[model samples]
Target: MKRTEKKRKDIIDAAIDEFREQGFLGARTTSIAQKANVSSRTLYNHFESKEALFEAISEIMLEQNRSMQPVAYDPSRDFVEQLKDALWGYISIITEETAIGLNRMVLSELIRDLDRSRKFFTETETHDYPMTQLIGEAMDAGVIRKADPVFATNQLLALAKNFFFWPEFFLGENPTPEGVMDDCIAMFMAHYKTGS
Candidate 1:
């Protein structure tokens, strides 16, 4: 079982690398098999088809990302501190070259296949379980006011997303700089900050 798990992980990692480099349609199972140092037959035993392997890679990446998120916001922290934590989390994760490449691959896939684009959106959206839960709690406690949690989620997420996601997608050099987080939190809090 341990050996099977290791082989599975090896194949998934190889497939992820291949798909990201070549896009899904362009990626080759033979290349992935060679990269994983596994025979074609062994690879097929692990994954039924190229689509199966790619979906496996996508699900694994999504689940891995979801698993790393925090469970909830610290109720004890001030709203501004919480906002900073959320914003900083987005900045820290998405700024990396690996994350950028993954996003680029998703966008390219979206152009050819709407379903693939939706896959990326679904993975990114509901997958941040911790943050979504916190947004609910904050609304319940009167720390922020919104009729619907989803609306609040959109607003808060939009604050952090537009800043870097735009720059990332366009390869724009300017990023939200180090000092800007504080100002961001300040602006965000001015709009929604409240007491329990």
Candidate 2:
């Protein structure tokens, strides 16, 4: 990578660590500069402000996990196997510490700055995530039946997260024990497959 690109990456990493540890409100440009081993001026040279840095954070997370989606149901794979693969993939990526920390930081920002949070939520979640598209496809294909795809998408994500993942973040340990991924996938599949 070019020298400028490397410095940009360095600043981004530093910002992520500070934002995760201190949140948007509490995170300091000085601390981020220290972590990046750059002057504060250099940090600003890459990103004009903390909000811009947070926008970079949002962009990075979305890019990395963009492909994390429900497996398009294939005739070849059995329903259970495909469901397990799709749901587990989504949950595992989104439930990681980095992802969770991002969410918490954004949520905190939401409380302080409703307009920014709402705008961020709409742009990022609506365009970047395929949550609605995934569930809608599942419904159209008869994998799941007679449901509001938007509501289903939200609830299913919340179920996997709130029931299985959030506490883990708060406690500083993921609760996904042995086979929990499989079990969680199966449990949600059970909901999706309930006979119409």
Instruction: Compare the candidates by TM-score and give the number of the best one.
Output: 1
> Which segments of model 1 are wrong by more than 4 Å?
70-75, 119-125, 165-174, 193-196
When summed lDDT is taken over every stretch of 10 residues in candidate 2, the lowest stretch is 124-133
lDDT winner among the candidates? Answer: 2
What's each prediction's TM-score?
0.80, 0.77
Please list the residue runs of candidate 2 whose C-alpha ends up more than 4 Å from where it truly belongs after superposition.
128-138, 146-148, 176-195
The lDDT values for all models are 0.71, 0.72
Cα RMSDs, all models: 3.2, 3.2
Q: Give the TM-score of candidate 1.
A: 0.80
At residue 95, give the lDDT of candidate 2. Answer: 73
